[model samples]
Target: MRAGTLIATDSGNTLAAVRRCEGSLERMRGLLWRPALVPGQGLLIAPCNSVHTIGMRYAIDVVFLDRDGRVLKVCPALKPLRMAMARGARQVIELAAGEASRLGLLPKRVVRWQETLTA
Candidate 1:
């Protein structure tokens, strides 16, 4: 998975630092063994509309995005063993619990993914 960040183009503010989990294996392993995501950290699963937290160690905020990076839905503080989905969503971002709200990632807001510099 390649690391990146989600930024609001309108405000030029960062929403979160994320890793692109595009492959099936990568998406399947989503937050399974993680204790919790630190602030500003998240996972991006492309071509996804639904997600399950059956084996996640901690709750998370699920932000659904349309093909154009528009926020479609947000499932906040989704606890373990839960699932969330949004119609017409092309990607899902698994953020730390409350991270979406803290970053103002509300429905209709726009965000763009940018690959950050890596050493």
Candidate 2:
């Protein structure tokens, strides 16, 4: 599989694509998963209730959101092999380590994903 962007409301929040594993709740149990995306990369709507782990890659910022897409937690530069947990997270967005700070994604911030038309 190829890597893809994790886009959000803000502009130029794209991150590098590494790898993504979706629809593997059973297989991802207890294992650290990181939503890998390069800086300034954009990602579409992603499901919550999933744990993302960043392995072998550099640090990244993590944003946990509720069903309404409200920012719950923003973990900046989360080290590799480190895990960020969000119990009520309806969706978790992974951004470049410092991109969160650059984009000013703070708590209670509202985020919306811009849909892309695919041919």
lDDT for each residue of candidate 2 in 1-119, tens digit (9 for 90 to 100): 22454444455563333233355452243223434555675332246544455453566677778887678888777786776777787776666678777776788876665443346
Model number with the top TM-score: 1
Model 1 TM-score is: 0.94
lDDT of 1 by residue, 1-119 (tens): 88999999899988788989868988788888866888989999988999999977788999999999999999999999999999999999998899999999999999989998878
The lDDT per prediction is 0.91, 0.58
Give the range where candidate 2 is weakest over 10 consecutive residues by summed lDDT: 26-35
Candidate 1 clashing pairs, residues 3+ apart or interchain:
none
The Cα error of candidate 2 at residue 79, in Å, is 0.4
Instruction: Give all TM-scores, in the order shown.
Output: 0.94, 0.64
